[model samples]
Target: MLAIRTKNLGKEFWRQKKASGLLGSVRSLYQQDKERVVAVRSLDLEIAAGESVAFIGPNGAGKSTTIKMLTGILHPSYGEAQVLGLTPWQERQRLAFHIGTVFGQKSQLWYHLPPADSFFLLGRIYELDQRTFEQRQAELVERFELKEFFHVPVRKLSLGQRMRAELAAALLHAPQVLFLDEPTIGLDVVARQSMRNLIKEINSLGITVFLTSHDTGDIENLCRRVIMIDNGNLVIDQSINSLKRDHLAAKIIRVRLEHPVEGLPPIDGAQVLKHKGAGLKISLDTKKLSVDELYMRLRQLAPIADITIGDPPLEDIIANIYRHNQGGGEGHELEQEVAQI
Candidate 1:
C-alpha cells in the first residue's frame, strides 16, 4: 500500500506588510496591507511502505507545508492527502496511531523534565498497553543509546543527547510511517552519523520513512528515491540513479601546486574554477578527459602537491539548481543549499 499520498496539495499564507518599530506595530493593527503568498502549489507525490524517500526544496517552497498536511499538523489550502490510508487532517487521531514525527529545530520535551518522563507522558497519551509500551520503550532506549542521561533533565542533556531522546519518543510506539524534518540539523559529525544509523535500522525493521532535509548526505545515504520541490511545485522525482545520471555531468579536480603558481596552467582537458594560494580547483568533462590522460598531462607540468578528482558534492549541485530556478537569491535558501555537506 502507498504509505503516503498527496494530490494537488497546496498552501497559502497571508503576508502582512508591517514596519519593524513598536509604534508601527501598534498602527499596523488597524492599517495593514497583506497579500496571499502561495507557499506551495499543486504538488502530487506517493511513497510506498518501507521506502526511504527524501523531499528537498528551498525555504518557503512548501516542503514543510507538504509535510504538515501529510502528518495532519496543518490544514491544506486545497486538494487532498492521505497517510497510511487515513485522511491526515480529517482523521489525524487515527493517522497518529501509525505515524511518527521529529522536527530538529523544535523541542517537544519539557525543559525541566527528564526525557524519560517525557517518554512516559507520550506513552500515556498514546495509551499504549503496559506490556507493549515497556517493550517498545526499552528497545528504543537501547537502540538510541539513551542510557547516558535517560533520567537527566532535558535541559541538562546535550543537544545530541536530546535529539536521540526526541527520536526515541517519536518511535516509541513502533510507528509504521516516520516523518523526519531536518532531524540531523545542527548535529556534529558523530551525532549525525548516529542519527543516520538509527534511521537505517528503523527502516530495516519495515518502517516507511519520509524525510525532508537540507542535508544531501542524508538523502544520498538513506534514500533510494528523491523528490525535489521548488516554489511549492515538484521539480524532480526519481531514483537516486536517475538524478545522478541526469545532473552529474562533470568531475572536480583539486590540485595543490608545489608552490603558488602565477596563473593556472592552461590544460587542454580542464578549466580552473578557483585558485587558493597553493591550491587550484578545476572542473573537467569526464566524458572527454580520462583520468590517465589528465594525469599524464599534469605530470609534464609544474610539480604537484596533491590531486583528487570527484563530482561536486550534492550541496553544490542543489545550490546551482536553486540558482537556476530563482536567479540566485540567498538566505534560508542558501542555508538549505549548503547544509547538505
Candidate 2:
C-alpha cells in the first residue's frame, strides 16, 4: 500500500511589498503591493508503506512547506495529495489518527509538565482507551529507556532526554507513518545515535518514515531512498546507493610517510590537495586512475607508514548537485519541467 501520494502538489504565499524609504513607505500605505512567492511547485511524490525516505533541500527550498502540506498544517494552493488514503486538507482530523509528526524546532510536550503527565495528555488527545493507552505507554517508556527521567519536568530534562520523550509521545497511538524534521538538530553525538537507533527500530516494525534533515548521517544511515529538492522543485529521486555511484567518482587518499620528503611524485588523475612533510592528502579521480596504480606510484616515491582511501562525503555530493543545478543549464531540466506545469 502507498503510505503517501501526491500529484502536482504546490504552495504559494503572498507578501506585502515594502518601499525603500520613509516617503515611499508612506505612499505604499495607500497603495499596497503584494508579490506571490512559490514555495513548492508542482511536486509529484509517492512513498511505499514501511519505507524510510529522506526529503532534503537547502533552506527556503520548500522542504518545511511540503511537510506542512503533507501533515495538513497548510492547505496547498494547487494540486492534490492523499496521505494514507485520506485527503490531508479535507480529512485532517481523521488523518491525524494515523500519522505522527516531530518538528525539532517545535515542542508538542507541555513545557512545565512532566513527560509522564504529557504522555497521558497525548493519549487523551488521541482518544486512546485507558487500558490500551496504558499498555502502549508502558511499552514506549521501556523501549525509549525513559525510566530515569520520564517523571522529570520537560523544562528540566536534557535535550536528548526530551527528544526521546517527544518521540515516545508521538508514537503513543501507534501511528502508521512518522514525519520527522531535523529531529536531532541540537543533540550531541551520543544522543543523536540513540535517537537514530530508536527510529530505525520503529521503521523495522513497519512504520513508514518520511524524514528531512541536514545531517548526512541521518540520511546515509537511516534511509534507503533520497528525494532531493532545490528552488522549490524535485531535483533527484533515486536510491541512496545509486546517488553515490553516479556522483561519487572522486576519492580522497591520505598517506602518512615514514620520513619527510622534499617533493612528491606526480601520478596521472591525482592532484595533491595538501602536503606537509610526512603527511600527504591527494584527490584521486577513480575513473582515470585505479587505487592500485596510485598505491604503486606512492610506493615508488617513498616508504609509506600508513594510507587510507575513502569516498567524498555525502554532503559534498549533495552540494555538487545544488551547484550544478544552480548554473541554469541541463542540470535544471527537471525543475524547468515542473515550472512549466
Candidate 3:
C-alpha cells in the first residue's frame, strides 16, 4: 500500500517586489508589484507503507515545502497530496491522529518542564489512556535509551539527549506515519546512530517514514530509496542503490606504485584527480573503459605496491547530480552503468 502519494503537487509563494532605495520603497508601498515564485513545481511521488525514503535536495529546493504540504502545515497552491488515504489539507485535523513529526531544528518540548511532563501533556492531547501511554513511553524510552535524562529539564539536557526525548515524544502515540525533517542535524555520531536505529525500529513496526535531510549519511545508512528535487521540480525518484549504480559506477582506482611515478598514467577515459609520492588517485570513466583494460595498461608502467578500489562518496555523487542537472532535468544527462547487488 502507498502510505503517501502526490500528483502534480505544487506550491507558490507571492513576494512583493523589493524597492531599490528609500524613495523606491516608499513609492512601492502605494503601488506594489507581487510576483509568484514556485516553491514546488508539478510533482508526482508515491511512498509505500513501511518504506524508509529520503527526500533530499539543496536549500530552497522544496524539501520543506513538500513536507509542509504532506503534513498539512501548509496548503498547496495546486495539485494534491494524500497520506494514509486522507487528503492532507482537506482532512488535516483527522490526519493528525495517524502521523507524528520530528524537526530537529525545532523542539516541541517545554523548556522548563522535563520530558516526562511533555510526554504526559502529549498523552492527554492525544487522549491516550494512562496505561497505554505508560507502556508506549516505556518502550520508546528504553529503545531510545532515555532512562537517565527522561526526567531532566529539556533546557538542561544536551542537544543529543533533547533530540532523543523529542523522538520519544513524537512516537509516544505510535502513529503509523512519521515526518522527520533533519532529525539528526545537531547530533554527534553516537546520537546519529541511535536516531537511525530508532527510525529503523519505527519503520519495522510498519510506520512509513518520510525524511528530509541535508546529511547524506542518514540517507545512505537508513533509506533504501531517495527522491531528489531541484528548483522546485522533481528531478529523480529512484532507489538509492540504483541511483549510485546508474550514475556512479566509476571505480576510484588509487595506486601506490613501486617507483615514484612522474605523473598519472595516460589511461583512456580516466581522469587523474590526485598524485603525490608514488600514490595516485584516478577516476576511471567506467562507461568508456573497462577495469581490465586499465589494469593491463598499468602493468607496463611499474610494479604496484598497494592499490585500493572503492565507490565514490555519496556527497560527490549528489553534487554531480546537482551539477549535471543545473538546468533542472533538461541538460547533461550522465547515466552510469547499473551496479550488480
Candidate 4:
C-alpha cells in the first residue's frame, strides 16, 4: 500500500515586486507590481508504506514547500495528492490523526514546561485515553532513552535530549507516518548518530518515514531511496546506491610519504590538490585513470608509508547533479530514468 502519492503536484506564491531607490519605493506603495514564484512544479511521487525516503535539494529548491503540501500545511496550486487515502487539503483535520511532523527550527513542545507535561498535553491534543496515553508515553520514553531528562524543563534540556523528547512527543498518538525536516540540524556528531539510530529503530517498527535534510549522513545512512529536486523541478528519483554509482566517479587519494616530496610526477588524469611535508593529496578522475595505474605511478615517485583512496563526498555528488541539470547536459537522461523508476 502507498502511504503517500501525488500527481502533477505543484505550488506557487504571489509576492509584490519591490522597486529600488527612494523614488521607486515611494511609487511602489501605489503601483504594486506582483510576480508569481513557482515553489514546486509538476511533481509526481509515491512512497510505499513502511519505506524510508529522503526528499532532498539545495536551499530555495522547494523541498520545504513540497513537504508542506504533503503534510497539508499548505494547499497545492495544481494537481492532486492523497496521503494515506485522504485528500490532504480537504481532509487535513482527519489526516492529522495519522501523521506527525517534526521541524528542527520549530518546537511543538511548551517552552517552560517539562517534557512530561508536554507529553500529557499532547496526549490530550490527540484525544488519547488516559491508560493508552500513559502506556505510549512510557514506551516512547524507554525507546528514546528519555528517562534521565524527561522531567527537566524543555528550555534546560540539551539540544540532543530535547530532540529526543520532541520525537517522543510526536509519537504519542501512534502516528502511521512521520515527516522529519532537518531533525539533526544542530546536533553534534554523537547526538546526530544517536538520533539517526533512534529514527532507524522507529522506522523498523513499520511507520513510513519521509525525511528532508541537508546533512548527507542523514540521507546516506537512513534512507534507501532519494528524491532530488532543484529549482522547483524534480531532478532525479533513484535508489541511493544508484545515485552513488552513477554520479560518484571521482576518487581522492591521500598519501603519507616516508620523506618530504618535492613534486609529483605528471599523470594524465590525476591532479595534485595539496602537497606538504610527507603528505600529498591527489584528486583522480576514475573514469580516465584506474586506481591500479595511479598506484603504480605513485610508487615510482617516492616510497609510500601509507595511502588511502576514497570516493568524493556525497555533497560533491549532489552538487554534480545540480550542475549537470543547470548545464542542460544529463537532465533529460535523468528524467527518463525517473519515469522508469
What does candidate 3 score in Cα RMSD to the true structure? 6.7
lDDT of 3 by residue, 1-341 (tens): 99999999988887667569999889877777666667888889999999999999888788999998998989999997899999998898889988999998999899999999999999998889989999999988888889998888999999889988998899988888999999999799998998888888888888888898889998998899999988788888999989999988687999888888676547778888898878888898889888778776776777888888889989899998887677544432222232222
In every candidate, how many clashes are there? 0, 0, 1, 0
Query: Compared with the true structure, what per-residue lDDT tens digits does model 4 show for residues 42-136?
Result: 89999999999999987888899988888788999999999999999899999999999898889998889999999988999999999999999
Query: For every model shown, what is its TM-score relative to the native structure?
Result: 0.85, 0.92, 0.93, 0.92
Model 4's TM-score against the true structure:
0.92
* Candidate 2 residue spans exceeding 4 A from truth: 265-268, 330-341
Candidate 1's displacement at residue 255, Å, is: 5.1
Once model 3 is optimally superposed onto the true structure by TM-score, how far is the C-alpha of residue 248 displaced, in angstroms?
Answer: 1.0
For candidate 1, list the clashing residue pairs, or say none: none
- Give the candidate number with the greatest TM-score: 3
> lDDT of model 1 at residue 105?
94
Residue 296 lDDT, candidate 3, scale 0-100 = 69
Candidate 1, residues 1-341, lDDT tens digits: the string is: 89988899888777667768998899788787665667777788888999999999888777887888888889988988879889999998988889988999998788899988998988998889989888988888888889879999999988889999998999987799998999999999999999899889889988998989999999988999999888776778999878876787778888887787666567766788998777878888767787677767766666778999888788877777876767634422322111111
Candidate 1, lDDT over the whole model: 0.84
lDDT for model 4 comes to 0.88
In terms of lDDT, which candidate is strongest? Answer: 2
